[model samples]
Target: MNQQSTLSSSDMPGFQLKALLLLGLGHLVTDLSQGGLPVLLPFIRESFGLTYAAAGAVLMTSNLTSSIVQPVFGYFSDRWGSSWLMPVGILTASLGFSSLGYAPGFWALLLAVFVSGLGVASFHPEGFKAARFFTGKRRATGISIFAVGGNVGIALGPLLAVAGYGWMGLKGTLVFLVPGLLVGIMLIISLGWLSEPQRAALAGISDGSRQGPRPLGKRWLPLLLLILAVTVRSLIHMGIVAFVPFYFVDVLKAGAGTAAKMVTVFLMCGAAGTLIGAPIADRLGHKRFFVGSMVFLLPVLWAFLAAQGMAAFVLLGLAGAVLVSSFSVTIVMAQHVLPDRLGMASGLMVGFAIGTGGIAATVLGSVADVWGVLRVLQITAALPVLGLILALAIPYPYKEAGQSEA
Candidate 1:
């Protein structure tokens, strides 16, 4: 294993800041496209006189397709080491999402959603690979920095939707295409710089000397537990996004604008948590920190459900910070488990797990229909117990790879 290639940021003070920032920008743009979709759903529903179930189907289709296909791309990326996917991912994501403004009917919108989902799926595995190339020792921190971009972009989606739809009508969606194109061009121009480390890694892999994936013998148990732990975390985070707005309006009697602001608080705080938690995870150990974060959530979620008004708001932000903080930690762990196939590890961590969360969203919504959103949230509060148990069992598989657990 070429341990020097994965050097710590402190060891190599001259890190690839330009490439990292550009990669972060691409993530921001792609997720911005994704984040905007929920905002557009209401407009589409109003224009088409569609039922809520039908409108939600648009999101479900996109999530389902993306979840299924991302690992395929990841597998290919590992084998081929393709640099084109990232730029192409941005371009296609833009095309699919931008077209939503002009879709004349239900099927047209569905088609657009599918294309946009594909773009999102294509970007992640390669994006994580690219981020790895730039970071040496501060892997969790670097991934967290990259992750904050997506969190910000997703948070910005609703704002863009409001501004675009309010100012220029549905056609305002086209504005998003401009940024995607510009970023894609920037990535293309920066390919030479980004490709250097990737070429070296590939060469190492070709010569059978690289660190990463190992044969899944007894190691499968830890990887499975980690995946399960992440699955629970994703479920809670996504559950908040899916249901919190309604909870605010229906239960707290907040106006639509206020509810929107609260959702923003949840997402933005999650981004902040990514930033704050990374350094802490670096020092405390990823497994211990992740387990502690999930265990801590039990009280946060209970308080959030039990409190009212300002107290609830504070708890919501706290919940967001604690739960979503594990996002990058889990991704880094996945790579450590299967170091050689970074692309595939990213696909499972980012793609497959999120899809599972989407299923949880669907099931939770159905449960909410019968049991009420408040009751359902109380049930969700208990999920972290499972994640905590899994975290305790997550073994350090990368000791052989010469990488320290973050």
Candidate 2:
């Protein structure tokens, strides 16, 4: 790569910085709408008098629906290449999320989340494929830039929910609709921006083919192992996000504001880790970076369990950073494994793997009911060990050809 190629400017081949920024912004709002739901869970529980199990059920419903549909969308994008999906996805997500305020009852709330989840599901496959093209040769850097939008949005969710719910109660969720609509309109207008570059410059990492289909028979073991690794990470992530506030408030006797702030701190630091780790992974090799991150997360989580107050907060932030660093790396690895199926790979890793984790959140909630949430944290701390084991099994790209390991 030359100086000009690394610049990420308008002149760089396949590097449309402006279009990427817009697509990233679109991703930001899409996830912002999704991320706010967990923040709203405690408030919703108190207002509706629901159990931890019920709350977990809500998350399960949303995650499962979103998980199940995303691969279908990815398959379509791979086969037909739809420009309308992105804008429509945003619109659908916005409307579904805005309905949370006046849902009236538990079933209605479930329906709202299901619809909102579908919207979330609709955006990722095509959105990620676009992000891939917008970066050209710098897929890692470009995907990181695009992924940071979701990272920031998810990080902001707790703070936004606290502020919105504090001021306007449940109805405050309607505020998300404004950004959703605005971004959707922008995506519609910028359709040409994504389409043009993809046609002109988009190419696969493993092979130089552009939008060409290829066989996947040789890649099954690696892809399955990759999905399992990603699933474990996502499971730990959603488990913490869904239950940590409850643990802080009920077990630690912390104030609601403090608990929300702690969650925000974790997510924000994770966003920082994504930005810092992506470029390094590009240079140092994805497998090493991912396995090392999971390795570091093990002790950090133990320290988080033992620490108190501000110390706990700091440890939590570190844990978030290490756990999240592999997110984009996993997605990019999936793409490398199935160069012709970028959309499917994106959906499988980003959507389905996350959905599987969301399903596990309910299981975690059930265990919490039996063993207590604090004990659950102790068990959860050991999860990274499993992730590290799987990370080690992720095959080197050149392993089959007897090339030197990365």
Candidate 3:
């Protein structure tokens, strides 16, 4: 590595709050479309008279397109700069999802969803990579802020969709078009400034002077284990989000309103956890915090499933926080392990791994059909054990000087 190419501590910029917040805003808008899709399923089903399986395929189409194609976009971003993708992606996603209400046929609906999914896929890799550069020394903290924006967007998506439907029937989805356009244009104007850190970081990576030696022994092994851990976490996350309302309404016999509120509370708590956990992880070590959160989650989730009333609510909130606290930690760890492939690492962590877990959660629908929602909840509760083991096995180089600082 050339001395000039190396980025010393002083050479690297400190946390750029404005840039991170802008990236976070982009994240929120991108995921809002994703979050809104599931809530619209029932209405779509009602309108089209489709079977449950067919309606599910709508979400599956979106998830598959958005998640699977992310790495390809990340590759492009790595090979060539991608600041423009952020604005283009936001507009495309907004346009596709907004048109959902007007699709004349089932296939048209899928096409719109697919387009929106592509937009979602395009935004994440570069968004995450830029978030990393903007945060500088506070990678975990900055990433958590960015991750929390997605969490809040997902939590709010259903609310916004429902409101739109209530106000103007299905066409209410058009309301999303406003934010997409506004934010997309804002990002475009900000591009020149935003690309500065990214150009520097890319230069460092390309020059082979970013950090210490890459991990040894099957370079992919560490990343594979990390992905497995993220997948398990996503499985539990998506499963709980998908099934918990049913569990509350059917088994616990809560009111529909209460059930809805529980989901919101759970998601909000997770967002809170993301903010609270990252700074601590920065000090305690990202891997250590990640593993500890997983270990703690198993018991908390089980108790939440078993308890009732106030106790159950407390446990549920705690479980959400503990489970989600590690979300940004895993992304940071992935980028650390694959420093040269930062964009791909971001895509795998935020896209493929999480999306795979969501797709796998659909299997729980089968479990709910054959056994019951309670059985599904039990299975969901047990998933963290696998995540814990994978976290333990990640082969994270805690002793490396570069890693230690990260």
Candidate 4:
């Protein structure tokens, strides 16, 4: 059998299912665990005596480190097994969160969260590789379903953190342990999250078992273009989300709880968008959605600031719903562009895009420093025009999706 054929699933009975559940769960855990910041930023700032800019920088580190580094790890996971990365990353991230609670000072806390993000860098490529191995044709739908759990984590994080912190002290917030533990347990039970049948088929193949991951084949140009577009999209995403809370407080004069809810609304819409985007792609096709997202988001985001109270909330929700759905489109585009390099695709979509966005968020925070939040968001809304052009650069049309799989 050819080397790729050697990967049939019969090699292990439950390996496929286990790998998938665990990997998805791992993604979900970090999403839930690190939610403390957005929920408690105001409190943390008051406690730490931080200015808005400084606190935003710390949050930026956690986000950027993972964003920037995930692609590197994605490339690695593509060549190596992702089996242990999730657990190890969770452990490190958990430790980071634990230390964050006890951090004696600001830099200490920032470094801890940054390290947490770095550890998170390991999951995307590895996880996506596993999902691809299983779903084969329906990979986009499958991965979207898996990824939405992360958004669920985002929704739950604030509620849990607030409840935990309310009941406990600083150490109480460390209750992130519960969610992380849930993921570890899920992985072990599933034998890891991959395809059961295919894994067995690959295992039973004729090639005498090899030890390492498959080699990363030739494919760099599309990856580069994907990165450029993804970088811009991610920056717009994080920059707006990061500052919305501040905008709520400073401009709209909303309460901390209200600001947190706005952030939650933005993320929630994103989560819903992803869920809908996946199915939407199944109907309208991915490329169409990719271009359409940019077109719709430009006006929605610009018009959002003009809204007030619940009106702003509804508009932001709609904006998030439409804009974030592009993630499904983008990730699918990346995977399609590099059919054999799912890990790198995941890395580009999840890692670099996020990291670059974090950096952009920091820089934009500075822009907001001078121009004000509304102006920054208004300008940031225009950034996606770059993505629109890049999306147009993507040559494969939706009509070809069915036959495009390698």
Q: Is candidate 1 or candidate 4 better by lDDT?
A: 1
lDDT of candidate 4 over 114-197, digit per residue (tens)? 877776776556666666565445555666766776666666666666676677755566787666666666655664334344
TM-score of each: 0.89, 0.92, 0.89, 0.85
Put down candidate 1 lDDT per residue, 1-406, tens digits, no spaces: 3221233333232346667778888888888776677656656767877754565566677777666577888887887777789989988888888888888888988898899889888988889877876766777888888888888877777677667877788878887888889998988888777777777666665666644444666657777887778778877776677667657766767765666667677777888998899888878888888989988988998888888778877888889889889888888888877766778888888888777776666577567667777866777888888878878888853465454544
- lDDT per residue for candidate 3 within 1-406, as digits (tens), equals 3111223444347788888888888888877877677666657877988754565567678878888788888877766767799999999999999998888899999999999999999998988877777777888998999899888877677677777888888889998898899999999999998888767765766677565334454658888999888989988987777677667766778764566566667777888899999999999988899999988998998888778788877888888899899889999888777665777788999889988887865577667767887998899899888888899998875334443445
List model 2 lDDT by residue over 1-406, tens digit each: 1000111223235767787788889888888765788878878888889887888888888888777578888987766666688999888888888888889999999988888888888888989987877776667778888888888888887777777788889988888888899999999997986766444433331234332454566678899998898888988888778878888887888888888888888898988888889889988898889999988999999999899988999999999988888788888888777666767889999998878877987888788888888977887888999998998998856243321232
Residue 241 alpha-carbon offset, candidate 2, angstroms: 0.8
Cα lDDT of candidate 3 equals 0.80
Which ranges of candidate 3 are over 4 A from the true structure?
A: 1-11, 50-52, 201-217, 248-259, 307-312, 398-405
Global lDDT of each candidate: 0.76, 0.80, 0.80, 0.67
Q: Which numbered prediction scores highest in TM-score against the true structure?
A: 2
Error of 1 at 309 (Å): 3.8
Q: What does candidate 2 score in Cα RMSD to the true structure?
A: 5.0
